[model samples]
Target: MMESIVDSMLAQETPAPAGNPIESAEELSSIAFGFMASKALFAGLHVDLFTLLADGPKTAEELAKAAGIPLNRIVTLTTALASVGVVSISDRKLIQNSSAAQNFLAKQSKYDFGDYLRYQIDQQMYPFLLQLNAVMKGDLSDDAIASYQHWMADEEQASVYSESQHAGSLGPGRTLARKVDLAKASTLLDVGGGTGAMTISLCNEYPDLHATIIDFPNVAEIGWRFVSEAGLVDRVRYIPGNAVQAQWPGRQDAILMSYLMSGVPGEAVADLLRKAFDALAPGGKLMVHDFMVEEDRRGPALAALWQLQHMAFTPDAHSLSVGWLTEAGRKIGFAVDDVDNLIPAMTKLVVFAKPS
Candidate 1:
């Protein structure tokens, strides 16, 4: 009777294969195995396979020698890299970067963005495992890329950030950059700009525009180097200052505060926003770019995850919704406008035109 009951249940048409319970369970299992995928990638990155291959293809044995890791580990790393689409194997030899790897992981590549993952391996991702604790309790740290900054300067991060950050990733600054008619704006100030990558990109794109990037002392030095390297020395200036206590030099056409907002308490961010607004000329525009949550705060995946990721560095680093920002602007004496999503993503530019 039990067998007959089971058969009867199985006899009912299972719709699409992907929709079937068995398939769904398998899909969930695959999702649960995501850690293995991340570990495989980390192992490949740990050995400098992508950086080594940046020059040209090399055999797994050669990679093992260059990376100073075990031969057995190299085999696993190389094969895993290939499986993960970061490398390609041709004729039993491990080739150099696959297109994706070259673009983001290869250190030498102009579009390299591997710095984003350095934190992943530094065990900073360990905190993310404590995400629930963060949500229920509070953040885990008091610094922004504190360990990472300890290792590399802002220029290092900028070099990688410039080429790799696509049009609309998962944040606000890039969104504002795309939406603004940068050609019309003559001057821009990137407050706490990491390495002036975004500002310089704007200046390069708009011949008439000039920009200034401000950050910590060392990061400012790096920003200057990037500006000089880009041959934007005359156009983009670097100001070494902290956004917390430093007074920004205003009187500019526009200001960009991106990615920086979420790394602090809500009150602190508001203070900076107000300060930025006060610094702006009546006709100037203040552009605020940061992650914005939905009305419910349960989100578009990546942004939701980012909320947990900001723990310890910035107390109330939750994603502020559009409504929240618009209201904030209205309370202050500026008009807040939401830049439509030209690219499909979570990034939305909030433009607060100061009577311009």
Candidate 2:
């Protein structure tokens, strides 16, 4: 009887929902005030609160003394940190709540990513988001908001940006190396490969794979240092110039363009794709890993937010859709192979291949 009932239910076709369900006013408000939580986390990271608590629990007074901040401010900050679950307050002392805080937040940890949050997200992108309204309205002049080229021209800013991105990219880079098959490929072209994080990760994974990283001179210099530090200087080389304009070093079996498309104008993407296609040997693979929106572009809230953030700085920055990319690849004589979300609902990897 149970088997029959289950079969009957399975035989019935259910209609799909019409559209996204409307969010509650309170939920909408929470989304709007999300910056408060971000700011709190940033503040905690900025003061190295997690690192201070790494030894053990500490009283607000002790934290204030160690961090050289006022006791009152530390108290308030600890309370906010507690609310965010990064720290816990027990017996009037604060303790690091999770291993994430200990591993990623602490300065002493080998996998520390605190600098990424501090420099890229907090110092750079946070301020850029504030200008979204002006940017959308076209009130902000091009010179007023610095493009990636302009920003990277400043060596100090480029170093900070590159280092921060390199730190943040490590985990994702390892994941990419594991997920993608590079065993058959001999040469890879890592376009706009900042600090050689991804290249280093890939080379570490594949013993026979050699990679050439192409980026601006300032970023390329930093990448060379990182590659050298990783002892991958022999396999991974840096080419200092624009990925789109500069002469591609040689024909590659695989090419990776990560987090580069969203920083450029939409019209320029096709040209870049064409360039990648032309630079690849027959049957070569091209991997584009970046944030992508759904066909409808309604809300995968993170991607939408990132798109808005990019718009604030870049003149034509917008989240590309997978369908568009597949179509674009088809037009460029490449076969679209797969589109998979590397970071569930956030970053996507769209893979294409040149026909042999």
Candidate 3:
């Protein structure tokens, strides 16, 4: 019965053309088995297989010796990794298939995001997603899974969460910096700014700009460290508190909320938008960078998946739409100036401006 419901839901959510039954079945199978690929990637990261192959190609015996695993297991894992294009085999040696692995998967690289892949995606989110069926059935209580706030309240958890998310945020942060015009703005407020990734990126782009990051105390501590490491400690400061209830420092020329709104209850978004409007200076701008579905709430597969995953943990959190945000901003007396895709179809940037 549950299987039938789930299949019905998928058919409605991602319907294929009327005559393309084979394509539909293939796509459905791919979606159902996505966990296999995810686990393969996670296994590679767990054993530092990518890092081991960073130097050059390695024979199965060499990989086994380096990774401290059995040769048979190494061969099996490498075959899976090779199938995924992360690694390749040439003349009985395994090689990292793409430069991306060397630059972003190897531990020694500055752009390495292995921790994010391991901790955030594999360890945390993967298990959380097992509850999706229960979540959709409304069988899980709010406390069934810890709220993000409660999860981050523990200093250790907060540290891990902040650090992992920071790595993933860098590229999007850099992209945001390039797209937005902050030249005339002196002060920016980053609401729920975890570890200051976007803040640091923005400050790097606009030397004269200073940023204040508002987030929980533990995350703020981690953010401070990141700011200090960036040598922008003087320009970026932490305001440690719950952004939703805390008193925002007023007179800000710009505000940023990246990947924040979707974590909070949907009912709170309007209030938060109102606060941003009130806190901004007369001509200030407010930016929301997040995962948004199309106005009809159909599939951009990644965004839709993320929305469902968020719903499993966050009671009222769901993927919102750009049209919804534009309407909300209009009610608060701010005009929607621009909307752009920050990361192709997955993430979006919507800019709203206070009337001059």
Candidate 4:
């Protein structure tokens, strides 16, 4: 009787839901196993799997040989990628790169973002997130919290971080160039600019504009190479020191603090805003771009996650919000001209203007 009842239940056909599935245990499971998915992507990128599959479909054996990964291991990696929709497998045992992988992950593609993923996520963030438990418990030492700055003091590591970060910053920099108006501005300041990506983008957009970047010595060294490559050396220069401590060129037409405010301590953010206000020329614009939550601080999932991620390195990092930034800029005697998303929900661009 039990077997008959079970068979009857299995045989019953149910209509599929027309819209999104309801929140359930599956959502919880997906969240719990999220790290495994991240690791799978890292592994595939490390092995150059996407590049191998970019040419065309290949059997598991062919991929193994081409990627120089063992057959069994390649199969395992490909299977995981397939499950994540980046790799597809057919009954004939052929594996192919999904459109997402072919366009963004393949080295031959112009939009290849593998470097950012490999360096920032795999090398840096992966290990950093491992200390979340200790960080939350307040068990970490001051040296541990300051480790990121110490690591950046090394030229080699700084180069690696800046190079990958430059790749990630270029798109947003170009976006800023298109969206923000700087036609009247002649000089600009890029505080904490990494690799001068925004400077290059803006310089490319406005032929007559010149800019100065303030960052660490090692980062400036790396950034010079990028500026030279972009052929903007004549227009762009660097001041190698802490941006807060460095002597900023006074009476600037514009100042940009991309990814700057949230990376520093709470007090430092206010100081930077004041410094930008002081440095800008009358009628100059200060563009502040960084991860920021909405006013209520309830959640924009990615912004919240990025704030948490930064905390893995910067224990005293400020919790940024658009409302707070606007209020701070107002307090510093600047008018908030515009506020909009730079990278959708992840970051915002707030333009503050000094009265002419």
State which candidate has the highest TM-score.
4
Off by over 4 Å in 3: 1-26, 91-95
Per residue, candidate 3 scores C-alpha lDDT tens digits across 1-356 of: 01222223334533332223346777898768878888998999999998988888888998899999998998898898788777888864645546767767888776677898888888888888878788778888767867887888988878878889988887778778888999999999999998998999899999999999999999999888889999997899888888888899999999999988887889888998999999999989999998888886665656767877787788678578899878988998998889987765567899999999
Tens-digit lDDT track of model 1 for 1-356: 01222233335553122223336776898778867777777666666678888888888788888889888888877787677677889985756788877766777765454655644333454444544465456444444334333423555544443323322222233334546776667888888776676676577668898887777676666557667887988888777667556778878788888766666667776777787788777778877666666666656445555655664434456567777877877777878755543222333457888886
| TM-score for each model | 0.72, 0.90, 0.90, 0.91
Candidate 1 has its poorest 10 consecutive residues by lDDT at 1-10
Better of 1 and 2 by lDDT: 2
Alpha-carbon local distance difference test for all models = 0.63, 0.82, 0.83, 0.84
How accurate locally is residue 238 in candidate 2, as Cα lDDT from 0 to 100?
A: 85
- For every model shown, the clashing-pair count is 3, 0, 0, 0
Model 4: per-residue Cα lDDT over 1-356, one tens digit each: 01222223235553222225449998889879988888999999998989988889999999999888889999898898899898999999899999878877889987887888988779887788877787888898877775556778977878878888888888888888877899999999999897898899899999989999998899999999999999988999999888867889999999999988887878888899899999999999999989998776765667888898888777778889989989988998999999987776567899999999
* lDDT at residue 326 of model 1 (Cα atoms): 75
Flag the better candidate by TM-score, 1 or 3: 3
Q: Write the per-residue lDDT of candidate 2 for residues 80-155, one digit (tens) a residue.
A: 8788677788864655546667766888876677888888899998999878888888999867988888899999
